[model samples]
Target: MKYTRILTVGALMASLAACSAGPAGKAELCESFDQLGTQLLSGNGIGNPLFRAADSLGDVAERYSAQNLGSDAKSLHAIADSDGTDSNELRNATMNIAKICGHPLGLG
Candidate 1:
């Protein structure tokens, strides 16, 4: 009985982790952008750097989406092309986009 209980708990935990690890939903993505916008407007100024980064990321995302390769290896290559030339700016921009677009698409 003790072993059975432990096994059951382990299975439950594994299932929960798998569910949470799924891709971001549309709602989550929207919420991420909304939260970033709110932070920018809240006068923290910290959000300025992130906002600029997000803008760049948005441009990249748009371009990738246009080519229908936003989620493909081609997109990564594009990111590498952009980043390899300007490591600092590329890092900052990608970070901002991740923050703002980290959530699912329609979250907000």
Candidate 2:
């Protein structure tokens, strides 16, 4: 499933490379990314933690369209659309976004 998810996201990224507009910068992405990370770590008992995190990522991914970060955004969309994605999938996506933003998030 992990490999499948990566392959799927990779395909989406290839398509997103054509975009030239993205978020103002990675800092903008980290703002939303950090908030979602906080929520995920809080164990606040949100019904769909992965989806919530993914939704936040999708919003940031829009800004990175030119950088081919759409995979993160698209993966987030897939997660938000369904409630069955495993934590590993979301975790990988989170890590990828964090690396791009140069922010190390505590996503316990």
Q: Which one is best on TM-score?
A: 2
After superposition, which runs of candidate 2 have C-alpha atoms over 4 Å from their true positions? 1-22, 44-50, 103-108
lDDT of each: 0.44, 0.68
TM-score of each: 0.35, 0.59
**Candidate 1 structure quality by residue, lDDT tens digits, 1-108:** 999999999999999987755554434444544553454444335434434434433434444322332442233345434422233443343343444455332232
Clashes in candidate 1: how many?
Answer: 15
* Candidate 1 Cα deviation (angstroms), residue 11: 0.4
Worst 10 residues of 2 by lDDT: 17-26
lDDT of 2: 0.68
For model 2, residues 1-108, the per-residue Cα lDDT tens digits are 999999999988877864534454666677777776676666536576746776866877777644667767777788778846655666676667778767655542
TM-score of 1: 0.35
